[model samples]
Target: MANVTVVDHPLVQHKLSIMRNRETSTGGFRRLLREISLLLGYEVTRDLELTTMRIETPIEPMDAPTLEGKKLVFASVLRAGNGLLEGLLDLVPAARVAHVGLYRDHDTLQAVEYFFKAPTDLHDRLVIVVDPMLATANSAIMAIDKLKERGATNLRFLCLLAAPEGIKRFTEAHPDVPVFTAAIDRQLNELGYIIPGLGDAGDRMYGTK
Candidate 1:
């Protein structure tokens, strides 16, 4: 609760509702996610630091605001996270990208990484980790763990939907990492899926059931 923000804009909520319907096609789902992510992106990046620099305009030269430091980095968590990545990039086109591939060990409910590639100088840039679902937080925790190991200090976790159980465990595991989501659902089902959620983000987004 200390660092979590739920984006409740009307457009986000309306698009989320459409995504919840089981009949929504894969293309439709992906489109809605793209739309909703832009709104969420705005909320999460609202406090970015800005610096003034002299610039020339049509009428005259004046001091204009620009983002400080190097371009931001967005670490997307595998397939599902990719859904949110594009929209966020649209918001910050100059941002760098990182990809992390992970899967859950069904028996242990742990996350296993198969691929990891991030940009250099992670320590100097703000890293925003994106994932569509924060179910049990195991994947989110592990993903952030990997990023921290690579010298990421300023980090944030962004998800489309989150479970209370996942949020509790995530915050406890990484208290320093603030979280942002479009909505916090009621609970996680027995299979660790968010209740009343839009369903498996990867499957719905890519039609890869």
Candidate 2:
């Protein structure tokens, strides 16, 4: 895909395989999600702009490279997105956080927003939207729309798995926003679930039915 980046790192693929196994316990699933997310986060933030700063090392003073501009924002799309958010935070502890609460209405497969809270200056920072799955893409689309309305100009979407249908819909909806994922699955099932995906991320992570 032109705008999509699939992180095919060995560690990522290994963790994702474990997560896809139905026999994996909830605690195991949760732990793997957090672990793989760190790897995925590394790829997503690879091109972050850097600036040079003068700092004294143990040996001598020199210009050190540091992230430029304002701290980036991680916009998590509701409950499931929190899985990826936790690990990304571990990587960038100083990054700003945003929460966009959206749940899929199973009957219509539409997203419904229940909550939203973000920094007031979204226009000035890079916003990376994180979610475990992008099956129907309804929730991801709506979450980004809300963030744009709030003045988020530069944005990206990150996920553990994505269906071809969902990727097409997401790219068409927001062409400028790049997508980062661990894997692009075969397709979406009739019920809007990613085929071969790790089941419902929220249910698996929380040990709920």
**Evaluated with TM-score, which candidate comes out highest?**
2
Off by over 4 Å in 2: none
lDDT of 1 by residue, 17-91 (tens): 999999999999999888888899999899999999999999999999999888899999998999899899889
Candidate 1 wrongly placed segments (more than 4 Å)? none
Deviation of model 1 at 107, angstroms: 2.7
| Clashes within 3 Å, all models in order | 0, 0
Candidates in order have lDDT scores of 0.93, 0.96
RMSD of each: 0.8, 0.6
**lDDT score, candidate 2, position 72:** 97
Query: What's the lDDT for residue 100 in model 1?
Result: 91
Against the hidden reference, what TM-scores do the models get? 0.98, 0.99
